[model samples]
Structure formats: C-alpha cells, structure tokens
Target chain A: MRTAEALRMAVEALRVNRLRSMLTMLGVIIGVLSVVILVAIGTGAKNAVEKEIAGLGSNIILVVPGQVGLGAAPTQSRLDLSDVAYVRRVVGDPSKVTVAVNSGEPVRVGRVEVFATLTGTDENMPHVFDRPLRRGRYLTGTDVDTRRRVVILGSEVAAKLFGDVDPIGRQVTIAGVRFRVIGVYETVGSTFGVARDQEVHLPVTTAQRLIGLPRINGIAVGASGPDEIEPLRQRVVAALAARYPDETFSAVTQTQLLGTIGTVLGMLTGVLAAIAGISLLVGGVGVSNIMLVSVRERTKEIGLRKALGARGRDILGQFLIEAVLLTTIGGVIGILTGVGGALLIQAVSPVPASITWWSIVLAFGVSAAVGVFFGVAPARRAARLDPVVALRTD
Target chain B: MSHDERAGRRDDERAEASAEPGAAGAPAFEAIGLTRSYRLDGGVQVDALRGADLRIGQGEFAAIVGPSGSGKSTLMHLLGCLDRPTSGTLLVNGVDVATLDDARLADLRNRTIGFVFQSFHLLPRTSALDNVALPLVYRGAPRAVRRERARAALEAVGLGHRLTHRPSQMSGGEQQRVAIARALVGDPRVLLADEPTGNLDSRNGEEVMGLLERLNEGGVAVVLVTHDADVAARARRQIRVRDGRIERDT
Candidate 1:
C-alpha cells in the first residue's frame, strides 16, 4: 500500500479511539515537557550567572592568597601589606590597585547591633571595585596614611544600624572600637546568594589596628583595558611569587572565571536534561504497550485487511505510522506547553528560565525516535499475525 | 433487474475477461487432493481437510454445506486463498498457488477474488464508501478513482445513497450489502461468501441471497458456505463435506 493510504487508515483508526489515543500520548507529552522546561531553566540560570559575572566588569583580576581551585587544600595567608605595594609597582598604577582584609564583626549603633562583614581597603576602593558612594566622601589617601578611624557603610548595613536616620555622620562601634561613618555605598545586589549590601568598609590600616590582624585576605586590581587583564594577572602572580617564593597564589581573570562557571553549568544542564529524558523513555514504553493493546483489539481488522490483499509490510507501515503520528502530535503539544511553562516561570518567579530552540528541536526529535524505536515490535507482531487465526477471533 | 443493469454487468464481465490471461478456458479455481492440518498446543495433530478435490468454474454458483467442525469453512478459506493446503495442488485463476510467494498471492487475491464474511466484517466506524474503497487502497488506486469505483460498486448493491453510513448505523442486511459492495469494488472474477446471510433475519437473509444471485447472474462466480439445507438447495451445485472430506458432489 502507498504510504499516504496507510497514513489515512492510521488516522481513521486513531480517530475511532480518540480518548485512548490521547491517553497513550500523554506519557510522551509529559516527558517532552519536562525535558524542555528543565533544560530551559538550567540554561537560563547559566546565562544569568554569566551576565552577573560580566556585570562585575571584565578588565579586572582577583588575587587570593594560597592556591584556590579544584582539589586545592586550605592554607594560611602569607600575604602581607608589602605584597600589595609590590603589585601596585608591578601594575605601574597605584590608584588602580587595592587590597581587602575582611573579618565578620558585630557593629553597635546606639544598641542596634547587627553582624556584618567588615572589609578594610585602601582609598582606591571605589576606583578598583567600581563602587559609587551615595553620600559623604569615600576614604581618602589621608585616612589610610594616618590610620584614621573612619568607615563606609553598605546600603543594607546603613539601614540596619540607623534606620530612617542619615547614617553618614553616625558613629558605629566595630570590634570594640568607635568609627565614624564617612560614606554610604549605593546598593549593589547579591551575587551567587552572597549579599554585598550588608558589608561595612574601613581603611585597611585602621581595620588592621582595630582587629589586631596585620595580614590581608585578597587583592583587587583594575586593568586599563581587556587586553591588559591577562598579562597584568600574570605580572601580579609573578610579583607575589617573588615576594613569597614558598607560598602559592591564585591570580584569576574574569573571563577564566566565566569559562569555568559556564562549563560546570553546561554539564549540570545536560545532566538535568538527561534525567528528564528517562520519563520520556517511560512514555515511549507506554506508547509501545498501548500499541500492543491496539493491535490485540484490532486482530480481526488485521485479518480483514489481509484478506483484502494488504501485504505484511503494508500492515507494518500502517501501525508504525499510527505510532509515530501519536508521538509527533504529543511532541508538538509538549513543545508548546514547555515553552509556555518556561516563560511563565520567568514571568512569575526569580528562578530564571528561558527556552532554547535546540532543546525544542531535540525534544521533538527524541519523541519521534521514541515512536520508531518502540513501535517496531507491535507493528512486526501485527504483520506476522496469521490471517486465519486473526479472522477466527471474534 | 433493469436492462441497463444487465448491460453494465455484461460490460464488467467483458472487461474482466479481457484483463485475465488465458481467460477463455481457465476454471475459476482447481484444487486436487487438498489437505490441511492443525497442531494442538500439546502436540496433538488434527486433520482439518484430508485430501479434498474440487473444481469451480467461471460464472458458477455453488454451495459447500457441512455441519460445524466438518471443515466447510476450511475448504472455503483454501479456495479463497486465505489458507494454504498442506499437501495438494491448488490453482487460482490458472496460477498455481505453490509457485507464488506471499506478496504475489496477495496480489492475485486482490485482482481475482472477493470475500463476504458471516459477521459482515465491515470496518465498524468507517463510512460505507471508505470500507468499499479499502481493497483499491491496497491496489494503489488514486483517491478519486477509488472513490468513483466504490460509489459504483455500492450502487450496484443498491446502496449508493447510503455511502456515508457507518456499519453500526446500518441494519444487519445493509452492512452485509456493504460488505458485498466492498468485495465487488475490486472487480474480482470470484466472490466468496462465508455464511453471508447467517447473521440476518429470514427476511433480510432472503434479500441478501437474492442480491448474491443477481450478482452471480452478472457473470461473477459465487461460492457460499452454509449449514442450512434450504440455502444450499438454491445453488446450481452442492458439495457435502464430512470428516474433512467431500462425501458428495452433485
């Protein structure tokens, strides 16, 4: 029989049992939908992270003491203030380099106490980190040069310590030492669930003196351009290596951070998509089971068609086409629902979700392939049925 | 029948005659010592047909009558090429069944034979027109041509106006007529009816019998299987089967 004729016959057969056909296709629908939706959410999260990292500025390098990466063991900080000056000299721009020494401290403002991350840095904090002050003056060269007891409050920290009150001139006690707030930072949102808004910054010299720690945690440097970032990172690493030849340092550019993050996120998305594909496989099995039942129910019809001169291959083509039609239709419906669900998530929630065209195409292709893979057994069974026995069935 | 119906039947016969190879002297079917057997699940073998010889000619109306389990249906199946005999030479339309593969045998069945079953075997949810067009679908006929042929065939069985009626919506007699129309739509030389009127009331049975007789008069050979003696008496030839053998042929 011609393929078109077989298709028409299959359409007729499926239409005869419309409810059963729809129910059979539900498994594939759910499978494809979950696959598309999950992959979309994963891809969206990956894109969001990439955007967030990019937002931090590209022409920068982050240098942390000790080797920090996969499989690296924790080590004590050997970095000191001299390393910062060395890096400054290496970069040839002292204004573009800064160092941060961080400690968690409880701050008291008229008995309104809150725990906040206290990071101490030089006067070039805003220039190096690209932070803008909302009020008052940022730390000047004189503050760090003289170890002045002055602090800059993050937006959240300002709100907590002095709610509705102008906090620029307010005095807050940190680590049992009183410091006047000289600046309030404009709000910078959280990255990777770590809030930047709840931090208070002071001059590194005053923080070292107040906390009794003379060592810094990490260094931040702003490169003049994207092209200088990599070479500048290597120079800083070499300079630090020269200062502490026995200790290791990690100098990482923003692009390297983004690439590592992208690879991990890509693998995570693929794994999630694969896990969702199992349900699709189960759905294909459902299709096969339903096809078997349909074949059994239509045994007499098979006999009649055979008697009417339908060849074995003709019967096979008929049932196989029917199965494929069932799944392809389900796949189309799934793609629509998955796209809608992803967009709905994007609209209503903070959990990022965006559909990818490849996921849609892949879901569709797998659903159809599921049909072909699972359809063969039942179709072959129908083809191999003896007409005499089938016709004998009531 | 009207004069026009007679002329149309004669035209069909002439078309079939010209299309057939060796048409002048070929018997519709010739079976010699045809035997068939079935193996039970526990390795018991039972003979369904034991060396039955039969010859049916063109334009002849015949009945094979036997009690249940006497293998009359088996004989009908073999004659219709729906089953192969275990150890006999069977010829359908002058071609030996033994020489043809499954596909060629199916093609031969398509071109030369039609079947009407006891249950009327019309697709329950399909329109009469589509059910009749099914055979031509296998024949690879174009849609328009299949529809036109199906319409003509249904009209021949006096059902042209009921083309769109499904089998469930039709009476038993009408469904059987639809089956007959489907059988004839392919323009086969032989029509095989297995208890064609068995499911209908006596009035409807008589109507179906009259219809089959009229179709036979149109130069198509007709073979029927029945247990009813009165039905068998109407045929031009009667073959009695018992113990998987033809006990009498007259």
Candidate 2:
C-alpha cells in the first residue's frame, strides 16, 4: 500500500480511541520534557560558573601549596613572605605579585561583631587582584614596613560593622588588637557560594605576627598578557620547586581552572540527560503495549485486508507507521513543553536554565527511535498473522 | 519483460492451449484432488478438504451450498487464494497456485479476485467510499483514481448517495451493498462471497442475491456460499458439499 494511505488509515484508527492515544503519548511527553529541562538547567549552571571565572580578571594565575589530582593528599605549605619576594624578583616586578593568607576572624565595632574572611596582602592588591578601594587607601608599603595595625574592610563587612557610620578611620578590634579601618573595597559579588564581599584585609607582616603563622597559604600573580600568564606560572613553580624541593606546588592558569570545571559540568549535564532518557524508554514500552493490543483487537480487520489482497509488508508498514506517528507527535509536544518549562524556571527562580540546540535534537531523535524500536515487534506480529486464523477470530 | 508481463504472456499461452476448438478461453479456477488438513492442539489432525476436484469458469453465477463443517468455506477460501491447498494442483487464471510465492499470490488475488464475508466486513469506522477504495489501495492506485472507481462501484450497487456513510450508521442491506461495492470496485474476474446474505432478513437477502445476479450478468463471475436451498436455487449452478467433499453438482 502507499504510504499516504497507510498514514490515513493509522490516523483513522487512532482517532477511534482518541483518549487512549493521548494517554499513551503522555509517557513520551514527560520523558522528553524532563530531559530537555534538566539538561538546560545543567548547561545554564556551567555557563554561569564559566562567566564568573572569566570575570575574575585576566592574565591571572594561582599557585597553591599542593599537588592536586590523582587522589593525593595536599601537603602543608611552608611558603612565606620571602618566597613572595623571590617570585617578584623572578618576574622583575614587585608590584605584579602578591601572597594571601586567609583565616576567618571576628571583628568587633562597639558591641557589633561580624565573622569575616581576613586576607593579608601587600600594596599591589589593587593591581594584581583587580580590587580598588571605594574609600580611603589600600595598605601602603610604609604600612607593611612598619607592621602597622591598619585594616581594610570588604563592602559587606563594612556595612555590617559600621552601618550608616563611615567605617574608614574608625577603630575595629581583631584578636584583641585595636586596628584602624583604612579602606573599604568595592563590592565584588559572590561565586560558587563564597561571598567575596565579606572579607577584611591587613598587611601580611601584621597578619603573620597576629596569627603566629609565618607561612603564606597561596600566591597570586598577574601577568602582562594572556600569553605570559602560563609562562609566568611555570617560572614561579620552577623557582619555588628549586627553593623548597620537599614542597609540591600546584600552579594553574585561570583558563585551565575554567576548563576543568567545564568538563565536570558537561558530564553532569550528560548524566542528567541519561537519567531522563529512562522515562522515554518506559514511554516506548507503553507504545509497544498499546500497539500489541491494537493489533490483537484488529485481527479481523487484518484478515479482511489480507483477503482483499494486502501483502504482509503492507500490514507491517501500516502498524509501524502508526507507532512512529504516535511517538513523533509526543516528542514534538515534549520539546515545546520542555522549552516552556526551562524558560519558566529561568524567569521565576535563581536556578539557571539554558536550552542547548543539541539537547533538543537529541530528545527528538530519541523519541522517534523509541517508536521504531518498540514498534517492530508488534508490527511483525500483525504481519505474521495467518489470514485464515485471524478471520476466524470473529 | 517484467514478471507481471511474463505471467500475463504465460496465461495467454495456457488459455490458448486449454481452449477446445470453440470453447470460451481458460477457466477462472481449475482444481484437481485439492486437499487441506489442519492439526489441532495436541496433534489431532482434521482434514478440512479431502481430495476435492472442481472447475469454475468466468462470468458464471455459482453457489456452494452446505451445512457447517462441510468444507465449502475452505473451498471458497482456496479459490480466493486466501488459503493454499495442502495437496493436488489448483490453477487460478491459468497460473498454478503452488508455483507462486506469498507475494505473487497476493498480487494475483489483487488483480483478479474479490471477497465478501457474511458479516459485511466493511471497515467499521471508515466511510463507504473509503472502504470500497481499500482494495485499490493495495493495488497502489492513486487517490483520485481509487475514489472515482469506488464511486462508480457504489453507484452500481445502488449506494452512490450513501458514499460518506459509515457501516455502523447503515442497515444490514445497505452495509451488504457497501461490501458488494468494495468487492466490485477492483473489477475482479471472480467474486467469492461467504454467506453473503446470512445476517440479513428475507427482503435484504433477496436484494443482495439480485445484486449478485445482476453483477454476474454483467460478465463478472459471482460465487456465493449459502446453506439456504431457496438462495442456492437462484444461481445458474449449484454445488452441494458434505463431509469435506462435493456430494452433488447440478
């Protein structure tokens, strides 16, 4: 039989049981919807993280005191202020490099107390970290030379400690020592759940003296250009390796960090897509079950058609086309629903959702495949039925 | 040449050879010792047809009259090419059925035969026109051509006005006419009908028999299966079957 006639016949058959057809299509609809929405959300989150990483200033490199990856335990860093100076000498620019020692500390202003991350660094903080003070001045070289008990408050810390009161030139206590808040850095929004606006900065020498720890946790270097970032990192790692042969340093460029995070997020998206695909499989089974029932119910019809001179392949084509038509329609509905759901989630919630073109294509392809895969057995069953037996079935 | 053209040529040669001086060409069906047996559950075999021989020619109105389990229906089925004989030779349109594969048999049936069942066998949800057009669909006829032929057939059966009506919406007589239209739409050389009027009242039965007689007079062979002697008496030929064998032919 011709394809057009077969399709028309299938449409007529399905129309006879409209409610049953719609109900059977529900499985595939939900399956494709979940796959599209879940993959969109995963892709959206990955994009958000990637954007944040890119915004953390260009030509930047991080040097941490650990040999990460391969399930190895991170070693404690013995890197100190001199190593920072050594890196500066290797780069031939003192202002282009800095060291950060992070520790959580409680700051007191009158009776108000706020827990904040305390970072100790040098005068090059603005240049290296892209951090500019909103008021007052950053810690100068004179402050570090004299080990002055001066401090800089992050925007959030400044607001929390001295709300409606100018925090600059005000006294705050840290670890029982009186310090003057010299500056308040401009707001830098949070990323990966770490609030960058809840920090307090002081001189590296003063933090070492106050915390009783002379070792720096990590080093931050700013290169002249993107091309120089990797070379600068290699030189730093080599110089550090030469000085402390027993210590392992993990040097990474910002791009490298972004790439690793991107890979992890991509896998996460793939896993979510796979989990959602199970529903599609179940939907296909529903299609198969319904097709088998339809074939059985139409045994007399099959016999009549065969008696009218329809070939076995004609019967098979009719049923198979019906099955595929059912799934493809469901798949289209699902794609529309998923796109709407993703858009709704993106608009209504903080959870990000980005619909990738490939996900749409994949979802549609799989739904159609579900039809063909599940359709074959029932179509074959219909084709293989003997006209004599089928006609006798009443 | 294509297989169909070659088959047609062979058919012509066989018809020329079988014609006896001034006889009307080849017979529509020729069976010799035809037999069909079925194995029931647990291997109990039943012979549906026990070595029966028959011959039917084109444009002849014939009736096979028998009671239930008499194998008249089996003979009709074999004649329609819906079932194959287990033994012996059966030729349809001058081609040995045993030599044809399933597809070839289907093609032959499509080109040369039509069937009508007792229950009307019209597609329940389809319009009369589409149901009549169904046989042509398997023939790969275009939509316009199928509709035109189906309309002509329905008009011939006195159902041209009810073209769009479904089987469920029509009465038994009208539905039977629709089945007749479907069977006649293909312009088959032979029409095999199993108890064509079994489900209808006397008036409707008379109407169906009259339609079949008219179709046969128009040079389309009509073969009807019935148990009623009154119905069988209307045919030009009567074939009585009993116990899987032909008991009488008049």
Candidate 3:
C-alpha cells in the first residue's frame, strides 16, 4: 500500500477509537514525564554543586589537623608550628600559605556579645582564600610578629557589633581582652554550610596568645594554577609524612573531593531514574496490549484486504505506523509536561531544576522504539491471518 | 444462424484467440481431479470438493449455483486464487496455482481477478471514492491516475453522485454498487461475485443483476455464485454443484 493510504487508514482507526487510544497513550506520557523530571532534578543538583565548587577557588586545598578516619569520631591534634615553618621554607612561597589557628570565642562590642569563629593569620590568608578586604586593610605580618590586639571583623560580625557606625577604629573585647577593630571584610556567601562573612579574623600570634595555644590547628594552601594542585598536594603529603612520622596527617586535593561528590550525586540520580524507567516499561506493555486488541478488532478487515491482494508486509506497515505515531505524540506531550513540572518546582522551592535537550531527544527516541518493539507481535499476527477463514468470519 | 451453430462458431473463435498466444491453447482455469477434505471433531473426513474437474474459458460469463454447504463457495474460492486445493493440478490463466508461492498468488489475484462479496465488504469508514480507489492503490497507480480511474469506475456503476458517502451512510444497493465499482476499477480479466444480491431486496437485487448483465455484455468474464434460482436464471450458462460435485451444467 502507498504511504498516504496507510497513514490515512491508521488515522481513521485511531479516530474511531479515540478514548481507547488516549487511555493507551497515557501510560507513555507518564513514563516519559517521569524520566524527564527525574533527569532534570539530577542535572539541577549537579549544577548547584559545580557552582559551589567554583565559588571556592578551584586550586584551594585545606589541610586540617587530626586524621578523621572514614566513619570515625572527630579528634583534635594541634598542627606543629615547626611543620608550618618547614612547609613555608620548603615551598619557597610565603604568598601561598595561610597558617591559621581557629578559636571559638565570645566577643563583646557595646551591649551585645556574639560567639563567632575567629581565625588568626597573616595578610596572605585573604589572597589564598580569594577573599579581599572590602573596607580597611587586612591583618599584616607586622601585627602577627608583635601579637597586636587588633581585630578584623567579617561583614556580618561588623554589622552585629556596630550596627550603622564605622567599626574601623572601634574597640572590642575577646575573652575579656580588649582589642581594637581595624577593618571588616566583604560578604562571602555560604559554602559547605559555613558562612565566611560571619567570622572574625586577627593576627596569628594574637589568636595563639589569647587562646593559650602554642601551635595552629590547620593550614590552608593555594596553588598558582589548577594544574599544579595535584602535584603540590603530593609534594605536601610527602613532606608532611616525613616530618610527622608518629602522627598521621594527610593532604587531599580539591579534584578528589569534587569527584567523590559527583559520584555520590550521580548514583542518587541513577537510582531515581531507574525507578522512573519502570513506568516506561509499563507504558510499553500497555501499548502492546492495545495493539493486540486492535488486531483482534480488525481481523475481518485484514482478511478482506489480503483476499483483495494486499501483501502481509503492507498490513504490518499500517499497524506499525499507527503505533509509532501514537507513541511519538505521547512523547512530545510528556516532554512538555516534564519541563513544565520542573519549572513549577523551581519557582516554588529552593531546589534548582533544569531540563536538558538530550533528555527530550532521549525520551522521544525511547518512546518511538517502545512503540515499534511492542507493535511487532500484533502486526505479525495480522499478517499471518488466513484470508479464506477471515472472509468467512462475521 | 441456428443456436448450436452460433455456439460452435463462438467456441471456434475462442479457440483461435487462445491459439494465438501459445501452441497449447491456455485455459483460463483448469481443475483436474481436484479434491479437498476437512476432518470433523469426530474424526470423520468430510469431502468439500472431490475429484472435481472443470475448465473456464477467457471472457466467459458463467454461474455456479447451489444450496448452502454444497461446496459452490469452496469452488469459487479455488477458482479465484483465494485457496489452494488439497490435491489437484489447478491452473489459472495458464499458471498452476498449486506451484505458486503466496506472494505470486496474491499478485495473480490482483492482476487477473476481482471479487465482490455478498455482504458488500466495504470498509465502513471509507468514502465511496476511496473504496473504489483501493484496488488501484494496491496496483501502485499514481494518486491522480488512481482518482481518475476510480471516478470513471464509480461513474460506470452509476454512483458518481454518491462518491463522498460512506458505506454506513449509503443504502445497501449503493454499497453493493460501490463494491462492484471497486472490483471493476482494477480491470481484472475475471469478476467473481459470491451472492451479489443476497443482502438486497428484490427491486435492488434486480438492479444489481441488471448491472452484472450489462458488465457481462461488455465482454468481461463474470462468475456469479448464488443459490437464488431466479438470480441464476439470468446467466447465459449455469453449473450446479451438489455434495462437492457438479451435478448439472447447462
């Protein structure tokens, strides 16, 4: 049969049973919709993590003290001061290292006293973290050497302490020791649940003296280029391994952390998508069932045509085309609904969601394949009918 | 001329026409010792067509008349290339049907035979024009040519004004006329109709019989299978079958 005639007949068949056809297509719609929405959510999470990772300088590495073994309780062992000095000397770059000791202390300004995390480091710390002073100068090496009692407050801490007044030359008390506020840094939003703009900073010697610590707790390192990070980490780990033979210390690269997070998120997305794929399988089965019923209903028609000289392939093509058209239309609707659903969620919730072009193409292709795959048995049945018996049937 | 002489002269002319194609004058159809049997539920073999020998010449209008279950329908099916005889050398238009594959048989049917069923067998959703155009479509005629030929066939059947009507919307007589148009559209060598007027009233039946008479007059070989003696009386010749065998030919 000609393509035009086949298509016309298929369309007529679908029109004659509109309600049943629509009901059959519903399964496909739900299946494609679920796949699209699930994939969109997965894509959104990946984007959010990537953005967060980008916010923290891609080359930045954190070397925290104490080996928190995988699934073990957290332990605190102060970093050796000599080790920090040795790292600075071995790296031959004073501008890249930020040796810092953090103390959780309560500081009072006027009437309100807020508990804030205080880190003491030299001026290079801000550059290493990609953080710059917004108002006044950052803490200097001179302050660190003299153990000056001058403090630099974060944007949020400054706001809580002085409200509308300039805190550049104000006085604050940390653990009952009076300190003069030198400057306030600009806001840096939350990363990994820790808000950078909510902390206070002082000179390294000042924090050590005030907190009664002989050595810093950790050191933050920054490489000049992202390509150098892994090599630098290896070098640092080897150096630390030699110096701290008794205490186990490790160096982790930013790439390793990013990879770990990506793997975890990818696994989660795969699980959700697999559950959604089951609906698609059910939809395919529904299509097969509908096609089987259609073949049964049109048995006489098939017989008549065959007796009139229609080839078996012609009949098969007609039914297959009908099935494919139905599923393709269903796929298009499902894609639109899935994208719309994702947009609705993004509009109402904090969770970000997005639809990718690949998802649309993939869903449509799968649905079409499902239609053809399921349509084969019925088409074959129709083709194999005996014309004489069929013509005799009422 | 006398009736016998006239018949003899026509037979000679038919023989001469058949001789021009090949040394062996090909019979339009030939069944030699054809037999068919069906095994009933009780393990008894019931013969549908047994040792049936028949031959039909080209451009011959013949009728096969019988009561129900007399195997006339089975003979029609075998003659129309719609079924394979269980055991026989059944040849249609010089080709042995038993040796031909399914596809070749379908091709032969499309090229050499057209059938009109008793129930009119029109696709319910199709327009009269589309129903008539179907045979041409199977023949792979171009769309414009198919439409023109279908229109001409509908006009031939006097259904030009009802081209847009579907089978359900049309009267029984009109639907049968459309079926006739569909059968004629392919210009087959033989037109096989089974109980062409079975579903119509007497007046409509007469009209259909008149149409068949007019087609036969145009030199198209027409075969009608009917139990109605009055319907069979209109034919120039009739063959009566009883219990899977031809009881009379006149």
Candidate lDDT scores, in order, read 0.89, 0.89, 0.83
Against the true two-chain complex, what DockQ does each candidate achieve? 0.66, 0.68, 0.50
lDDT score at residue A381, model 2, on the 0-100 scale: 97
Global Cα lDDT for candidate 2: 0.89
Give lDDT tens digits, candidate 2, residues A1-394: 7788899988988889999999999999999999999999999999998877776677788888887554668678788988888889988888888888888999998899999988888888777777767999989999888899999998999999998789888999998999999999889766666677898999989998989999988888999998898888899899988988887898888888788888899999999999999999999999999999999999999988888888999999999999998998899999999999999999999999999999999999999999999999999999988888889897
Tell the DockQ for candidate 3.
0.50
iRMSD, model 1, in Å: 0.7
All candidates in order of TM-score, best leading: 2, 1, 3
**Fnat of each candidate:** 0.64, 0.67, 0.55
Q: Candidate 1, after superposition: displacement of residue A295 in Å?
A: 1.1
What interface RMSD does each of the candidate structures achieve?
A: 0.7, 0.9, 1.2
TM-score of each model's chain B: 0.91, 0.90, 0.88
> Highest DockQ: which candidate?
2
Model 1 steric clash pairs: none
lDDT of 1 by residue, A39-123 (tens): 9999999998887777665587989988767678866777778888988889898989988988889999887998998988988
Q: Which regions of candidate 3 deviate over 4 angstroms?
A: A64-78, A99-122, A132-218, A246-249, B1-25, B38-46
* Window of ten residues with lowest summed lDDT in model 3 chain B: B16-25
Worst lDDT window (10 residues) for model 1 chain A?
A188-197
Model 3 clash tally, residue pairs: 0
